[model samples]
Target: MPNSTTPSSSQALEAVLARVDAGLDASLERLYALLRIRSISTDPAYAPECQRAADWLVGELSGLGFAAQARPTPGHPVVVAHGPDQAGPHVLFYAHYDVQPVDPLELWHSDPFEPQLRTDANGRQIIVARGASDDKGQMLTFIEACRAFKAATGGLPLKISLMLEGEEESGGVNLPPFMQANRDELAQADIALVCDTDMWDRQTPSITTMLRGLVADEIEITAAARDLHSGMFGNAARNPNQVLAEIIASLRAPDGSVTLPGFYDDVAELSPELKAQWQGLGFDEKQFLADAGLSLPAGEQGRSVLEMLWSRPTCEINGMIGGYTGEGFKTVIPAKASAKISFRLVSGMDPDKIRAAFRKHVEALVPSDCSVRFIPHGGSPAITVPADGDYLRKALSGLSAEWGKPAVITGSGGSIPVAGDFKRILGLDTLLIGFAHVDDQIHSPNEKYDLDSFHRGIRSWVHVLASLAE
Candidate 1:
């Protein structure tokens, strides 16, 4: 008879990793099956498809011994699954089954729903489909890791819960409500794991430790009762376009810092350790600007490009409209001028306060005769994971071991509102780890996930879970 005793951590990890490697083909097959589902959640036409995706997930999780069910919401359903009660740290894994619409379908080399494994010009195997790298492929990495654990050890080392929602692409209007209603059940987990982000590069893995928040608004300035011929009004009338332009220009100082009053009041300085780590990333600022067809950095004088992107706040004019935007020239000043503006906020800053400050700044800049109207476009605060957390260090070590390179800690210039929602609602800090690359082209046609990324992503999760359990 074979000796039957508890396997050491290294033995268990090795077994699970071998299982992951052996099951790579099956894992790809399962991911391909998921990508075949046209689960576009934004459009009303794909409602049934969204439901089908949710149902498929429930079936898969239930088959894996989870108490999985497709729970109803005001919009699409959320698949909530729970594993058998265990003794280790419980983790809630979050990912969306829904994908962005595959519009401009002619641009795709193949059908977006029919995923294919093909080699790129650089000779790397990639899986091509709409949601290949966005979430479908990424989400399956965790599930496949669990499968390997089960196959190798007959059970998982820790407790697990899965939250796969179908409305993330459509603004996720109902997700907060759904979470609130089930807060007691969902909050039981020790931490949340999200897999809807990207890696720093092809060779280096990354954990997004901070995500900047957003505050967006639209402003309309009306200076005249009706459109007037410029010749007739000539240099005498108050021009809303000129007024709007001046206000936009005044938003930034010559040093490229936002000039709003008290804009930096709540902003925190980056720690010395984090600054050192980011400096070691060897980011080519010149090359970065060259790729964007620019010659110089445009934000925050004396700050590195990464620091400006990931730490500092920003004010940008997204769009502007006043008069005579057509092909031909019209010598008239329109009665109203409008502009869309947005602010990217860092940690410690409140979105509501930022929005209010922006409105106040614009109001002060408006001409006495001109009237200004504001339209709110919603806001969310920034999210930051603690640098010294035990879970974070363990996860990083796991990734480093799997990838054969030291994993990096990076910050995102964009926001994932769900991370904030997780903290606010469930009182859980989320670890935003994903294996997608920058060129994955998610939300665009011809989206793909590197075949190696998918395979090693499973093993990476296995390592992470084992390290956490230890």
Candidate 2:
């Protein structure tokens, strides 16, 4: 039997932690250097910054004993790198280097790019900048972890393949095609490790187990051949805006549950195990609401805040536009009004069926004088990572050993398209192990990643790799 001793390992970990502590300054320096690059993928002006970020990653990967390269996609370049060993189960590590734009820059405590290390009023020293927490901070957690392994062990504890993309924030336009084209090279991994999710709380680590599915579409309603002044047409013409509002309003009831025909037909309710797990989390809804600047649960009347966010499905009108206003509003009954609507579906929900149901609902609602058309976007089904899977047990063991506490297997409220894509195309299960926190403020101004998360994240990855080998 394998020995159950940890004294030697504990010594090694302490020694590694010491090296990590010593290297914190240099790590922050590297992070600041990376943050300095304006890798805003959405803005065409920052294309060079994107390339520079990829180049920087390539250099780091090469320096860390990997054959790394910056390969161009239709959009910004993707940073690819791999370990020398091919004997172990291949694991693909993922993180996005590109960050959102730091607009309305006045809200920041300091310059967005010109990062500074400062202690907040609470005495927590944080790295402040635009990309500090969003992704550059999050991505560096994995990279810096690899750095520590190399520093202490002369090599990584396991073989790693990195697929750091640039277009995650902007809907991952090129990632699918990029992965598809490089299927032979990318899909060889036994599993994928996505480190772009949030922790349960600041102090508690989490393993994301489920991601809600998404189906988006725009509905255009036409009531007249052309716009007509409300004064001239008064009581004679149908106002497309009103019609649109009624149709949109009809999709939900007072309780906030989606009222679309058959919208809940395929929704899977939370299992007893899941319910018990979430209940055991001890998450205070009041505190969570306070953070979000709200007091009431606005989703479903009978569900917990965690349920509303994680397990329950929702339908929301992303945007709506009708009529016109330059300086003052024009009292015109517009010929057409559109509402961009989307659905967050649970497992067992079929996107096609939901689409059909929505179309039928709209068709039934619109009168003969009014016409409606639907534009379909790509839809994906929800994914549930088996909590009882062998990999999860091993992964939790690894995380527990590192964090000195049980890792929370949580559910992600948002959609991660790649996870579903991997399930469909590669058949590889994703282990959502990330070190991000709620305050990281991804996609918001003044995004920042925590320093401790960065240092500990690397060692955590090392432990996970070790666990996987067993």
Candidate 3:
């Protein structure tokens, strides 16, 4: 086991952090080198660039004494690295090396592949590039921290595994299969760590503990045999548009709750401790709505916006297609209307059960003559790391110590399926810790990673790993 004494451990942590501070410039140079690789996994033309990125990671990890290799997949390569086997907690670190396609090239001030350090209007020194804040810069923070640990000491404090994928920006269709095939190797870790997330603010660090799952479904309703002219059959025929509208409206109540039968049967309520933590976040509901050009809280009245976003299950209409939608109006009632709907599920909610309830509700609302068909897109369950886990407390304490503020436990309103994959396939819970800011503009033109975030991010990991080693 690693040393847990206060004085020696503190001194070791301080030394590692000092090493990170001294090596900042060299770390930036290394990050810039990786950023220059155009690893756009979605585009077939950049396949070689993706391979180059995987190889580069393999080389870096291997130099760190990890048994690293670029494993091939149907689309891109996955870089798997294993650190020295030691008698301590094992962690699987996950990050992506691929970047999103940078369209609207005119918007970028410089080459997307050419990373530049410049001061922003806010007076923060930022690194600008396509994948600066998304994953490249964020991922490097951990690697640099490990470098510091090895440099300051001699080896890592614990067992570690690295899984770097080149197809995260694209659909990670191959990752689940890869994990399943290598389950025995990957599942040896006690926990997982992911860095593709953002901080609460510039000064406040946050760890996302809860991630809502998703269920996407498309439904088409047919009322009449063919399109009918309103002038020719005004009130004589039924319009599928109207039928679809009523059915859609019937799914939600005036109080902004789902109308499906027993929809909340399996829903779990927040713990008192978690609820109190969320209340302490000082979230402004009006400001949040104002930013979105909305003036009202639209879901489950009497709940805070943060609660609705982070903890509650939600049903929303994503899109709808009915009747004619063109420049010139067409006076015709279309024979078919389709709507795309999605549900955000919390812990204890089953996606299959929710889907079945929605289909049953829609079927009950349809007219006897009308027909409805449901098409399923995808589904995944919510992920929650036990609040009382040892690693969570250690990581939170480490983050708090690094940022000079109490690290806030937060939740994501969207899904990160890889976390769920680790749970289902590897039986490991993931800690979603990152150092990017809310305005990093990831996947957009002129994306950036704050210099402070990068520097302090490495330091944070140093402390976290040291704490976890205890």
Query: What TM-score does structure 3 among the candidates reach?
Result: 0.97
Give all candidates' CA lDDT scores. Answer: 0.91, 0.82, 0.91
Off by over 4 Å in 1: 1-7
Off by over 4 Å in 2: 1-15, 324-330
For 1-470, candidate 3 gives per-residue lDDT tens digits of 45432214567778888999999999999999999999999999999999999999999999989999999999899999999887778999999999999998999999999999999998989999999998999999999999998888878888889999889888798999999999999999999999999888888888899999999999999988999999998788888888889988998999999999988898888899999998988888899899989998888999989989999999999999998998999999899999999999998888899999999999998889999999999888999999998999999998999989999899989999899999999999999999998789988999999999999999999888887887
State in Å the error of residue 281, model 2: 1.5
Cα lDDT, model 1, residue 171: 94
Q: Give each model's clash number.
A: 0, 4, 0
Residue 295 in candidate 3, Cα distance off native in Å: 1.9
Q: Over the stretch 146-234, how does candidate 2's per-residue lDDT look in tens digits?
A: 78767876666556889999888777889888888888888888888888887777667888988999889899999889999999997
Which 10 successive residues of model 1 have the least lDDT summed?
1-10
